[model samples]
Target: MSEEEWIVDGIDHLNYRAVEGVYLSELNVGLKKLILHDYPELSDSSFVSNVHLVKYRLIFMKNVIDKANKKNDYVRETVYEVTKNQAYETMDVQEEWDNTITFGQKIADIVARFGGSWTFIISFVFLMAVWMAFNVLKPFGLVFDAYPFILLNLALSTLAAIQAPLIMMSQNRSSDYDRLQAKNDYRVN
Candidate 1:
């Protein structure tokens, strides 16, 4: 091409021409918008040389453009697709999952919280102390559960059976949430 034909004006009103076989002025408007969106600091300032902008766009937006092209999406305007993908990727999956949790899951979380607290421990200790004291101090014929405390044993065993599963369910949910967070972080990075 002639030198005059090679020189063209960029979106920022700066003149650019073929540099190392890359033509900045020939870039698609959508790609220009994507470059601007990716680098807000470059949006307002005119680049001293077109070489830097061309190199940056090629290095940074190549993957995004290729992915958009592969999906056959944003063929006319890649900025929209890129922005939409970024928004979706950065969304809080944990909050969305928490919102979708079932009533059973909420109950399991509550049970797990209460089971791990000092209040449960203190109240259980107090109840056992009172039970032992009453049974030991009362007359022999009036004692309902003797020193063996079979009723207490059965109740404790049932509580353990129910509590173990609830705690495990909550832990599984916590692990799932952590995994989701890691996935989001990986995507964002």
Candidate 2:
């Protein structure tokens, strides 16, 4: 190749244009040190192509991750797993969780979603008002439940008892998902 079209790479010793990567002369001391940490044999004037640069960049990342003071071994393991190019070893937290849901968990999720909505609140208020009005005013000329509304109290109490456990179950699943997401984020970072 013509001298103007191709220049020699100081590290890989291949003929490449300057635009293909970068010259070590342009790098700061710390950056040069990081590069040299992986390719120690490279001279002070090394020219690195982009492809080889990517590999060294990964090494630089590994060095940074290794030096990190994070106390979580899960994060460290995930970083190592990714650095080793075993991407398939890691799973999508949401997808895995969704795939593992049981019928009871699905019902709990639906109940929790509805119980926390405006529609449920409005419907509940309207039902209580209608029940009290029907029993006290005797609008239908026959009050099945008297002013005390014993049946309404029983229904409300039962609803509360069942709703509480379902909502708690949903919250537990949410907490698990948050934990899985945290671990997954570490792998990406």
Per-residue C-alpha lDDT of model 1 across residues 109-154, encoded as one tens digit per residue: 9999999999999998999898888788886657878878888899
Q: Candidate 1, TM-score vs. the true structure?
A: 0.52
Model 2 Cα displacement at 130 (Å)? Answer: 0.6
- lDDT (Cα) of model 1: 0.70
Clashing pairs in 1: none
| TM-score to native of every candidate shown | 0.52, 0.54
Model 2 agreement with the true structure over 107-144: per-residue lDDT tens digits: 99999999999999999999999989889998758898
**Model 1, residue 40: displacement in angstroms?**
48
Compared with the true structure, model 2 gives a TM-score of 0.54
In model 1, which regions exceed 4 Å deviation?
1-89, 139-141
